[model samples]
Target: EFLENYFLGIFTCEAILKIIALGFLLQPGAYLRNVWNLLDFTVVITGYITVFAQTGTGIDLRTLRAVRVLRPLKLVSGIPSLQVVLKSLIKAMAPLLQIGLLVLFGIVVLAIVGLEFY
Candidate 1:
């Protein structure tokens, strides 16, 4: 818990510095145009909500903890190759789903054929 809190603090401070450097509301366009900025904002907000909800409401927010796991994705935004790969995966998801269904249908047909042979 202590390590997690430490890293969260680091990320929170980093996000704050980024917002300040970006001039915050003064240049919203510069800040929002990059997908990485969006990710940073999301992770920071989720972190704050997790901390506040845990302390203020006296309730465990497990879901917010899960959201915090997205911190590693920050690294993804730093790498050009990873960004291309991530984009490709996102763009391919629909076709991949269709391929998966086709494979499943083939498996079912093979199973039926085997049963008949038995």
Candidate 2:
């Protein structure tokens, strides 16, 4: 509990600083434009809710603790090369899905042929 709260406090402070640096009220602002900041903001809010929900209310927020794993994704967003690769992957999703389905179909056909031979 102590370690969790300690990390939460640090994340909260970091979120506050980011909000300050990005300006809270700007439309389509620097902060909103950057995916990393958005991810950081989301993780920080989730962490806060998990901490407070556990302490202030009777409801268990154990499921929300899993959201902390997303914090590491913020590092990916920070890297320009990784961002480009991620964008490329998203763009290639349709082709990838088609290839995957084709491969699955081939495996099913092979299995059927082997079964018949036996």
Candidate 3:
């Protein structure tokens, strides 16, 4: 628990500094404008919520703990190459989805023909 809180504090400090350096949401390149920063902010906020909920709020926000798992993804923002790869993957999603649909349709048609023959 000590290590969890320690890391949480570090992440919180990082978020605060970034928010101060680059505006929150109104500016052109605000902290929340970047997808990775937005994700970090979410994980930090959820971490706090889970901690506070457990301490005394009794709010039962256990589900929020799952958001912490995304914390490692914040590394993508630190590495330029990784960011490039991730951006390309995201861009490719639409075409991939179309191809997947085409394959599924072909399989379904084959299944129908096989059933009729049987």
Best by TM-score: 3
Find the candidate with the highest lDDT and give its number.
Answer: 3
Q: How well does candidate 3 score on lDDT at residue 14?
A: 92
Tens digit per residue, CA lDDT, model 3, 6-107: 989999999999999999999999999998999989988888888888998768875787787787787787889998998899999999999999999999
Q: Which ten residues in a row have the lowest lDDT in candidate 2?
A: 24-33
lDDT of each: 0.81, 0.81, 0.90
What's the best-to-worst order under TM-score? 3, 1, 2
Residue 14, model 2, lDDT:
71
Clashes of each: 0, 0, 0
Model 1 agreement with the true structure over 31-81: per-residue lDDT tens digits: 556788788778878887887887789888898889867888877877889
**Residue lDDT tens for model 2, 1-118:** 8987887788778767867887764755766567677887788889889877887989987778889888777667668898898789989999999999999999999999999999
Model 3 ranges off by over 4 Å: 1-3, 26-28
lDDT of 2 at 58: 97
Find the number of clashing residue pairs for candidate 1.
0
Error of 1 at 18 (Å): 1.8
